[model samples]
Target chain A: MDIDQILDSVSPIHKDPKAILKSYIKEVNFPKGHLLLHAQKCEKSIYFIKKGIVRAYSNTAENEVTFWFGKEGDAVISMKSYIANQPSYENIEVLEHSCFYEMNHTELQKLYNEHIEIANWGRKFAENELLKTEERLISRQFRTASERYNELLKNHPHLIKRVQLSHIASYLGITQVSLSRIRAAKN
Target chain B: MDIDQILDSVSPIHKDPKAILKSYIKEVNFPKGHLLLHAQKCEKSIYFIKKGIVRAYSNTAENEVTFWFGKEGDAVISMKSYIANQPSYENIEVLEHSCFYEMNHTELQKLYNEHIEIANWGRKFAENELLKTEERLISRQFRTASERYNELLKNHPHLIKRVQLSHIASYLGITQVSLSRIRAAKN
Candidate 1:
């Protein structure tokens, strides 16, 4: 999808403002398994995925727990780290060979500083993300493991084929064995 | 707490911009048990509480599930409903007699449209909300029930004194019996 289209989808921006935002966005690539961000390191950039998948996870005492998946056309950032300007508690890794448009902190600051429309877009985008995160929180708090699995399937069926089952199990906060049982029962 | 101080803490704006924002805000009062928002009803306003508490929850087939508590200095909105311009899935109610500075949706849009600094502050505010929601999502996904209870105690010890045990149990995603057990174990 076109970058302008992605920006528009995020929040409509006029042609002139979109052009300015486009100027700051730099295209980059990553191989599968590459760690785009590491726990304890500060996040420096926000990425908009042009293609492929990335997983955000945190290393707990026992294991790595998957938090979310960002796929084609999704914007990915270690939001906590970026907003706080502190070291990240989570790591982000490419799950597939990925193409992205990255805008570093400085560029993002500049965009907000220079363009009111862009700033408005940023607010709307963050509001959208907040809503999504709240929904996921609600699901985790209120839904059964099977229900969460079904939700994932209903919302992002493409993720099932694209990422490993282990990652999905982690995201669902269920043991791999339990996930397998759920899948078996469903079938 | 002073409304100006709360606004400053959220994101600072200069005198002129602050005046513009202040003009759009209107102080309102709600008695305890008043429903600020209801499920299936579109949210019309965002509120900055100057005093007292509000609870956000959703009614499921079996029961009402508490999602969050917004206290003095906190901003409360049916964010999903406001962002999507649809009926809310959650309800917000005054848990205590409350005073708030309310800004309706159209007024918010006008502020964003006419004031660059206000739009920038809105972006910063949304980003903060996103980070907070992400933290809650992570906690729900990874923490043990007891751990979650401890987290709430650690972060907002005052809430225990303000709200009922049943509400806390709902927020923790545990049954009242389980919560009682957890509290007993902790004691």
Candidate 2:
């Protein structure tokens, strides 16, 4: 999609579209296997994927967990660090060659300042992120690994096709061996 | 501090003081042990505490997990549900008799548009929440019960002093007995 379409996709709830869509956005492209944003860096901008895929994950001492995956028309950033103005705890890596429109923190604040519609969009995004996080937390708290895997398959089928099995295993909080067994059982 | 100071604290970040201290913001007081926001209902606005404490916890089938504790100068709400216009999964209960400015989602969005500083502040707050959640996830992954308890002690010394052991236990992903043991060991 072109810049205008991308901006339009920014939010349907926008009432003051003209004010929010300021002229600061710049579209950029990245090659596959590239790290668009690294962990431990403070993010000044949140990326909007016009055409591409990116994965957000973090490595602890023991292992890594895939926090999320972003596809076309999705927003990708290490949300916590980006919002907190602290160094990010998650690594955002490009999974495929992609095109993105960058909206830096200052620009977003400008949008928030210029238009209530933009602030509303931001509020909506925050709420969306919260729901997704809550769902992950609850699923981790209650669901069995197998159940989660099934739900993931039903909801984000493209993830299975796009991501490596190891990342999938990490995301599910299970061993690769367990995932393999599950896959075999299904077959 | 007075309302001016509060407004001042927000001005550098939100540029416009009038937009933030807008008409929707009315003063509200909660007695100790009052519920500010309830689970299973849509939260219209978030409360910004001028003084006192509030707890945000979710009720699972087996137990309740205390995830958030807001103090003076902190904003409290069923954040996920509040942002998303969905029913809240967690409830905010006032732990200390408190005074706060109650601002709903719509009014806050309006404020963000009118005041750039408020929008920046909102981002910072969201970032803080995200960082906390990431820390919680990592703590769950890497820390022992004793380690987690110690981390909590170091991070939120005041929380230990103000809240019940049961709530702390839930927050730390342990039992009250474990907290008692940890406390005993600390001494």
Candidate 3:
């Protein structure tokens, strides 16, 4: 996405492109398999993807669960740890060669302090993140593996293409074999 | 539980106390049993409690789960719906007589746009909420029912005394009798 698109995602109603683009938000490029963030490290920044894909996942004794993924025009971060300035439980990795604009925690705060419209934009975006997390929690509670798989596909079709079957299976709280069986049954 | 304390929570380093006090926020009172916010209503306000207890919960045909509880210094709202401007799945109710400073979603924006520090404060608080939800999700997936119950008791012991047993049961994903048995065993 272009700078305009990024700015729009930020504050559609209020626009001051020049002021929002300066300082902390600098663009960075990554290759596939790049680990943009590490698990258990304090989150220092949040990223906005200009192109390509990023995934948030973690390894367990058994498997990896894809908790979140972002493509173009999306924000990516270890948000929990980022906000707390504590160690993260999840990692952010590039699924494809990607370009992102990075905003350090402090710079973002300074920007918000400097510009009310920008701060409002940040607040709304955080709200969106909160809603997403809430929905994930409820879905995990109420939906079955197959149902979850379908919902995931419905909401994030791109994730199906970018994510591995094993990761997808864990996210659905099922085994890889069950996911395959469900796929077979569906077809 | 005072306004400044709540304001300080969001802005630790540089806070504009009076600016936060403005921004369409109004001080109000809620009696026990008051429904501060209802599901499916379009509300713009979130409450920063000065006194008393409030609950955030959702009812299923089968049960009700306590998603969150708020007391003095906590912000209370139908959070998911509040952000999305959609029908809420959860309800916010006063569990005890309470006092709060409230502002509509628009007022929240007004504060953020006019006061960057307040906006950052909002982001931090929202991030805290997201972290709580994420941890709860992970716990639901990984922790045993007994473990979760222990956590609730440890973190919010007052909830055990204040909330209904059935709601607690639902939150723990167990039956009322089971909760009763557990409580009896513990006592």
Candidate 4:
């Protein structure tokens, strides 16, 4: 989806569409396996994905834990780092060659201050993110591995084909062995 | 904090503080153990706590998981239900005799439409909530039980005295026996 479609999808930008587009600096192509964000760095910008897939993960003492994935038409921001202005605990990695539009934090804040419509769009975006993150957190806390896997299958079947099983396992807060057993049981 | 103070604490409200106050219906003197919200019910309103503590928990197949706690001067809502307009997966139970100011969702949305300052406040509020929730989710995902216990003790020392250990254990995603051992190790 284009910027106009995305802006309207969240909340309509009734005024100053040009200003919004200008604020987003176009990034045409980022290679696969690239790190858009690194652990311990503050996120200076939010990226709107035009194509490809991205994953967010953190390196624990033992290994990496994949927590989230973003696809086309999704906005990718490290909420803690971006909003709190702190070092991020997670890294955002591109899983496939990607194209993006980037908005610097200060520029976005400036737009929010200048335009009520932009501020409303931001409010809706944050509300949507909060809802999604809360749902994911609850699932991690409450659902069994198989239940989570089944729900993922029903909701995002494409992920099974696109994302690695190990990353998916980490996202579900299960070990690879448990995920394998669950997959076996499913068949 | 009163409504005015809360409003200014988040973002400055230059226009129509009275309307905002009118939108928030004052609710007072709720006794301990009162439930502000129940699992499976739609959250029609958001509550700003004036006094006391509140806990959000969900009952899973095995037992209850206490995921979050709110204190004085905090705004409490089931973000998933409130933002998505869905049935809540968590129950918000008051842990102490509490007083709150409530704002119905529709009224707040109306205010957001009419007032840019209100929209800015809402945006700031959502940003803060997202930052906090993201932090908590990361801790849950990556921290060891003992590390979580230690961090909780260092950050929220009053909680050790004000809240039950059982709820704290559940929040840490550990069994009560393990919590006891962690406490034993600490002392």
For all predictions in the order shown, the interface RMSD in Å is 1.0, 3.2, 1.9, 1.3
lDDT string, candidate 4, A5-30, tens digits: 77677766665654565556666678
Model 1, B18-94: lDDT tens digits are 98888888999999999998889988998888999999998889998998988889988887666888888778899
Candidate numbers sorted by TM-score from highest down? 1, 4, 3, 2
Interface RMSD of 1: 1.0
Instruction: Tell me the deviation in Å of residue B153 in model 3.
Output: 1.4
Model 3, stretches more than 4 Å misplaced?
A: A13-24, A59-64, A177-181, A184-187, B12-27, B61-63, B177-187
Flag clash pairs in model 3. Answer: A116-B113, B40-B88, B44-B104, B44-B105
- The sequence of per-residue lDDT tens digits that candidate 3 reaches over residues B130-169 is 8777888887765667888899889888867988877778
* Candidate 3: RMSD to truth: 3.3
Clashing residue pairs in candidate 2, if any? Answer: A83-B127, A84-B127, B13-B117, B14-B116, B14-B117, B14-B118, B15-B117, B45-B104
Q: Which run of 10 residues does model 3 chain A get worst, by summed lDDT? A: A13-22
TM-score of chain A of each: 0.95, 0.87, 0.89, 0.93
Across A30-134, the per-residue lDDT of candidate 3 in tens digits comes to 999999988878888888899998877777676566666678888888776567778888888899899998878877766766766676777777778788788
Best by TM-score: 1
TM-score of each: 0.97, 0.78, 0.84, 0.90
B66-138 per-residue lDDT for model 2 (tens digits): 8766777776777656565778877888888899987778776666666545665564555455555656666
Positional deviation of residue B18's Cα in model 3 after best superposition, in angstroms: 2.4
Q: What is the TM-score of chain B alone in each candidate?
A: 0.96, 0.81, 0.87, 0.93
* Model 4, residue B187: C-alpha shift (Å): 4.4
Give the candidate number with the greatest lDDT: 1
Candidate 2 vs candidate 4: the lDDT winner is 4
Per-residue alpha-carbon lDDT of candidate 1 for residues A45-135, written as tens digits (9 for 90 to 100): 8888998889999888889999888888888887866678888877989998899989887778778878899889888888888888888
DockQ of each: 0.83, 0.27, 0.57, 0.69
Give me the runs in candidate 4 sitting further than 4 Å from their true place: A15-27, B15-27
